[model samples]
Target: CSASSGCGTGILANYFDHYTVFNKPVQSGIAVGDFVTLEISSSELFSRAFMLYIFPILALFMGSYMGMRLFPATELWQISFGIFGFISALLLTKYFVK
Candidate 1:
């Protein structure tokens, strides 16, 4: 959407400028029309990032540990349960994001 009406254009522009994949500097004042944008605070973005990235790994580790504890001699069970836990964490994250 155009910033002519003074929406969140600045915040979005600044975010893109600071956080591009190639680390190239981006100019501000870029605008898009017909594109939906959700406004979120930086802290919220970081929190969500942590949940999206870190939570699944942590869940996998915990799940594998628990699986091992439950089935000490079964290596397959540990791997299967770890993968299951990771997927479940991701699904939960998707549901909460929506």
Candidate 2:
């Protein structure tokens, strides 16, 4: 177990002979080099995937649509709004994922 990025607890382990690092809580009595089991629910995985991938795209499209309606003469405004929306969604996703 060791400190990961963002100062969270993490574990470095070997899986399928490849070294991988996971940011997860460690139980008491567990030590480095000890074997442990990790499990993730399908629903949780799906939710995370959707938030990380789909949500930002949806936000960008919505923003583009709104910008087009509000600024019909300016393509620049539409693209700016879409980029802003994508960035906002990423920030929100980061906050919620934790």
Candidate 3:
């Protein structure tokens, strides 16, 4: 877990922990029946993490820059723009994933 990125797996696990609707059961610690699977490679995983984490940060910077240009150099407006940028990045990420 330490040698590689496991945050995505951790997120899935936490989600499953709270919502049993997607949980599955195995009788002998083995997949014996219909099971869901995903075909993802390590490189793809890393790329996804990179996009998810870095894109928002980049958007934040761009948003702050635009905010500075459009509004007064006030802390509140800068933070608001940062948040808007993050949300826009998230929306874009969702679209890309689909």
- The candidate scoring highest on lDDT is 2
Q: Model 1, residue 36: what's the lDDT?
A: 39
Which regions in candidate 1 have their CA more than 4 angstroms from the true location? 1-39
Alpha-carbon local distance difference test for all models: 0.78, 0.85, 0.75
Model 1 residue 63 distance off true place after TM-score fit, in angstroms: 0.9
By lDDT, is 2 or 3 better? 2
TM-score of each candidate structure, all chains considered together: 0.59, 0.68, 0.55
Reference-based TM-score, model 1: 0.59
lDDT for predicted candidate 3 compared with the true structure? 0.75
lDDT of 1 by residue, 1-98 (tens): 44635766555565554443333344566554434344579999998988888999998998899889999998998998899899999998988864
Model 2 lDDT per residue over 14-93, tens place: 22334557888898999988999999899999999899889999999998998899999999989999999999999999
Spell out the clash pairs found in candidate 1: 1-32
Ranking of all candidate structures by their TM-score, best first: 2, 1, 3
- Tell me which of candidates 1 and 3 scores higher on TM-score: 1
